[model samples]
Target: MSDPVRLGDVLAGMATPGGGGIPAQPGAGGTTCNRCGARADWHRTIRDKWILIELGEWPVGAVPPGKRWRVAGEGTAVNLGRAQPSDTCRICHFDVCPSQPAPVGSPALLAQWQKNAWG
Candidate 1:
């Protein structure tokens, strides 16, 4: 099989903050994508386990407001059930991971990203 799509790399330029910071987002992590060996961060979701999010700052309006994630204090990525006016989100790496066996209806923003932002 072919390698998975590194969505982070593909979408880095359009990262919300226009690409700043050591990683362009807080909550620096040691975790790596097992499928592609790329560095990814995580957030403990309100309804599920730790999820891998891209290490870039995605705009608040990039996806549906309800699906946004904001970096809380002390290196924590918090799932905002709905976004505040001044919020940004870290896209789930799985959104475009070419070979990711993403569970059915699993990665919340992937469909929106595909429909709105990406091909």
Candidate 2:
């Protein structure tokens, strides 16, 4: 049997850089939020992208239909929760984080992602 899904798994499956689930494109890896057709971006902190999922800012289940909200500009890290971005493939949502950058990839760029990411 496979291991159960952890918060990391959920985030990674979304294909964001950290555990945060932000797709560079909606439906990039067949990723679909029950509420939103597809995630626009991962961090509202970077740009207003995701909807709150609901009032009171609850987790997965508590989100009310239509009321989903997204974060933008610096919000408290605590509010963001411990979640990171998806390591899964940006296409299938079924891969782990890449440890090494591709050939010709800039190490400086990856370093910036590491600084901003949780892991």
Candidate 3:
């Protein structure tokens, strides 16, 4: 029988299907909430915004017809060019946080993921 797939392999496969284009690997930045010191896992970056534009998912130079991209502070406009790097805490869901660049996957974490996926 075929061996089980490793978690890293599965994640890498999902990140870059068919090895066709640049993989959207998560940023190598371990972000934490400035207010509460909680670790952050969510991020909004320029590359993500551009993908939406390139796929025509977000209309350029106009307000999107629906309430899709409407956040409390951001208006209902689809401005891909204005995208910035923002991180959110996984535990608290806080938006205001400062992040430091760190390696994307630690050796231990990667090993654990691989074991879990294989098993």
Candidate 4:
């Protein structure tokens, strides 16, 4: 019998590094966010849109499990699936964007901004 595909599995399968997804362009990998001017590493998402991945990786527990991300082999930003013990994941710049207010009622996100965010 075959195992049923779950939503997470489906989502993960949709993004394979160096697969059909758009390649990261030269000089676009590093830049500053115009809204708040924070340093970030940009990568093209599978959906064909740009995403601002923070320049560093943090402990898996530092951010919510679902919010964690990792750079794929081809420079694509992808979710940090099924975090194991002591795993580290890169973060999205939007979570710490000083120009935008932190999400209400989520202490983890708020704490992340207050502790290590940059303008």
Q: lDDT at 99 for candidate 2?
A: 34
| Model 1 C-alpha lDDT versus the unseen true structure | 0.55
Top TM-score: which candidate number? 4
**Better structure of 2 and 4 per TM-score:** 4
User: What is the TM-score of candidate 4?
Assistant: 0.64
TM-score of 1: 0.49
How well is each residue in 30-105 modelled by candidate 3, as lDDT tens digits? Answer: 4443334544333332233211111112222222122123221321123233342232101112211122222123
lDDT of 2: 0.30
RMSD (Cα, Å) for all candidates, in order, is: 15.1, 18.6, 17.5, 8.8
Alpha-carbon error at 52 in model 4, in Å?
A: 0.4
Which runs in model 2 stand beyond 4 Å of their true positions? 15-23, 26-71, 74-119
Worst lDDT 10-window in candidate 2: 88-97
lDDT of 4: 0.70
Q: lDDT (0-100) at residue 38 of candidate 1?
A: 56
For residues 15-112, write the lDDT of model 2, one tens digit per residue: 45433544344322223333323322232233324322211223323322222233333431123232323211111001111332321233433333
- lDDT values for all models: 0.55, 0.30, 0.30, 0.70
Off by over 4 Å in 3: 17-61, 65-119
Name the candidate, 2 or 4, with the larger lDDT value. Answer: 4
- Estimate TM-scores for all models: 0.49, 0.17, 0.21, 0.64
lDDT of 4 by residue, 1-119 (tens): 59888998766755543444544443366787777777788787666566788787787776776677887788867866567444678878888777778855457567666654543
